[model samples]
Target: MSEAGDATVDRAHALDAVLLGGPRTLTLRDLAERSGLDLEQVRLYWRTLGLPHPDADEVAFTCRDGEALERLARLLHEDHLGSRTMISLTRALGHTSDRLALWQVEALVEDMATRRDLDDPAARRAVLDELADLAPVLETQLLHAYRRHLAAIASRYSVEFAAGQDVGGDPAALPLARAVGFADMVSFTRRTAGLGSTDLSDFVQRFETAARDVVTQCGGRVVKTIGDAVLFVADDVRTGAKVALELARVLGGDLDVERERGAGGLAEGARGVTPVRVGVVWGRVLSRFGDVFGPSVNVAARLTDIADPSTVLTDPATARLLVDTPGLLLEPLPARELEGIGTLAPVRVRTA
Candidate 1:
């Protein structure tokens, strides 16, 4: 390859390294070492681009540099931006807008409160103009942040639970009640890995949207989602059962659109769009850091493990609690053994 080609390759690799969690402020020396390019070669590209080279004393760089480097890396990776590129760019723009708005909001709030004595109407108008200018940008940022946060949450529930000696959380002592149970996605490992990040993002968003709608609609709160399963809590078992049923129905029915899109789409290919197994149980549990714990929580998880996709499974006790609620049918599952929890008979809530 020619000198230009080698230089391009070096920069490309450097950017990849940075994007994948390299130091924020990298010096030319560091780039030369990591990129296999001589210091002079790395310097040449910076000089050619008319960007400044901070002194070695100022070697630390910010995440902004890392982002810029990532952009450059992507440019070098492809002669033209493709679909993946567009998706990445869109996600990045959304993230950037969020960070910028957070910083801007702090500044605006500080200024608004501190400048009470600026009596000139023109100055006041300027402040109002600044706020007006920032309104849409800040609103977009908030919406994006909320959307991303929610997507991350729904994506957690699509998995099976495995107990390990791995790091565990410190238990808290507090006023406790038997909160609701939450079940995660059953085929999360296979499904999530097969989907691209953007698609994974979309899948998560759809799940959260549906889940939140049903939970709030039925007067329950979704405490949090953990790795493809959501943790929800209700004041009592009946409410929990109602919340669980609504979640399953919303998720199962919502797959229709993805089903029609095509066979290989996430909705269908993942064994049914929004088709998630649900488990509802009631027992004393502790809540902390947007998560619930205790034996009740574990049983709910295990029950979800036993649930078939598009179905809601509840412990026999939960079924008994809901026995009086009309139109909610329950059928016994064949005697089955579950990990962590022993031989059990769960009632599947049959849909009419």
Candidate 2:
């Protein structure tokens, strides 16, 4: 191998050691034997972790892997966890970690390339070099974040449980009575058409960060961010309205000056801040696989599609709930024909 290739392999091994807490010493077969699990069982668990199963003879397993397998085996032996549940748990961890790792590495690469003026390959190399030092910190932070989120979920569930709310249901069943909303950037394609990669990334990141802040501060949670849009949810209509109105006010105001400038035939500003339109609905929704669904979600998305830039729109049901809300003004629009939902009145929401 070339000296560069050898150096890269050595660095990878070093990183593996740091992350796995030791060198890779066990073959797949050895790991199975050490953990008192059969090869097939090992493969099943490994594959569920979103990792490729190595050949039985391949010395790719570390002590950490063996320990994990042993713990899993113990749980199974004691009937503490069913095989299907274990598989599901591992799959969830694997899927989430895969995306989280990729996002962090890419963010690091972007920062390195932009701040250090390095090319992509050089930035990746820098990331690899820094991983040994950063891995432990990253791991700790991941655990901390996961624990906090888990605790919050537990607290929320506990409250409902104490209130005699029905918390038992099929894992894949849809949620009921959720406030679903969508906020989409107006003229996103046009605004970003001329931006370079770095500028575009910055713009999108800025929007997502700002939107998340607004949603969370308003007692709602962002479900996910699609390109040029964000989906959010709250337990009640009031919180959803607050989030939608706040996003429209803050994200839409950016375009106010631009609109005036454009009317006078002036050039756009360099900030690239795009205006957003929001739609919110209070209705039952199906929550599965970390995403929301159902008629409410669809209606919210469709409403967002037709809303004026920098404004919040809601169907009559949500509007009725928000009509008497303090500090909010709901201007009822005439019933209009929505493609799938037919004619329905949508209310424009603003801060009173």
Candidate 3:
């Protein structure tokens, strides 16, 4: 009997093998085979959670280490969270992790631990109950901290808005504070006017969808949508620039949907999609009511206007700050006479 029980233990250990390797980055096929899920089921989860399909070329999946797989599997299976909600929750939780505020981290860690299969039944229940009780308190504390930090930083930079008015604030600003920039669709004046309502809606939806994915992946926040454009803020310049460049690059490369709509799935005669231009500048700003503002904010808007339809442009200050950033290629542009700002030397950013 003891030998039989030992064999069962070995089986449990083998099942834990998935947790051994960090960020397996497995494909849909791999996930399906390992998790006993079908491809369609996995696809549903991805769609529900608004996750991009894993690319064969890119590091498709990852975790801190294989040990995380145990928790991840429980979250996926026992929690019964569909893929879409799971994805959104993952992003939210992941963002929270980036912050160093002790209470927030502790709260998250405590909540996460409740999902584990603990040996002590009484202790497990107490852990979960305590987390549930403390969650709201932790959330409130996090918000207060974020707001105070944002106010302090914005004050430090003496931020000013272009509209000569108050821009809204972001509730999640402190602890894991960041500078975020968003570049958006130009206007209703563009090609959108000629299309039907459904077509126009589809175009706008796709743009927003793609933009959000890029921002989340780059560890930035989308404060809110300003009609045609998105307002994004990142924790720092490198992250902000990467988000902008990625938005431009991904949007530029993905024209299949447009081609399908324009030419009824015919590739040869389909009109190409004109991707949105991106501009990013990083500096501390005032975040209020889910909005961001300041002088660095104004310069970012102006720089966006100067960018080509599918390129990212940044101010000299932002560029200089990123001189040491790895995997970034920065090129000096001819001293362009920027309106109101005068003879600006902006640097174009691309992946190195």
Ranking by TM-score: 2, 1, 3
Q: Write the per-residue lDDT of candidate 1 for residues 200-290, one digit (tens) a residue.
A: 7557755665566678677678877665778788766777878888777656643446646654533243333456788888766765534
lDDT of 3 at 45: 48
In Å, residue 71's CA in model 3 sits off its true spot by: 38
- Whole-model alpha-carbon lDDT for candidate 2: 0.83
1-352 per-residue lDDT for model 2 (tens digits)? 9887788788887887888989888888987898788899899888988999889998897899899999998988877798888888888878888989998999999989989999987888788899888888999999999999999878977876677644257565454667899999998888788888887886787678778878888999999999899999998899999989888876754643554454221123322257789999998787666788899998999898789988999998888888788999999998888888888889998898
Weakest 10 consecutive residues, lDDT, candidate 3?
263-272
Best candidate per TM-score, number? 2
| Candidate 3 TM-score, C-alpha based | 0.46
Superior by lDDT: candidate 1 or candidate 3: 1
Q: Which 10-residue window of candidate 1 scores lowest in summed lDDT?
A: 158-167
lDDT of 3 by residue, 175-215 (tens): 23345565855444755667864466556655666667778
Q: lDDT for model 3, please.
A: 0.62
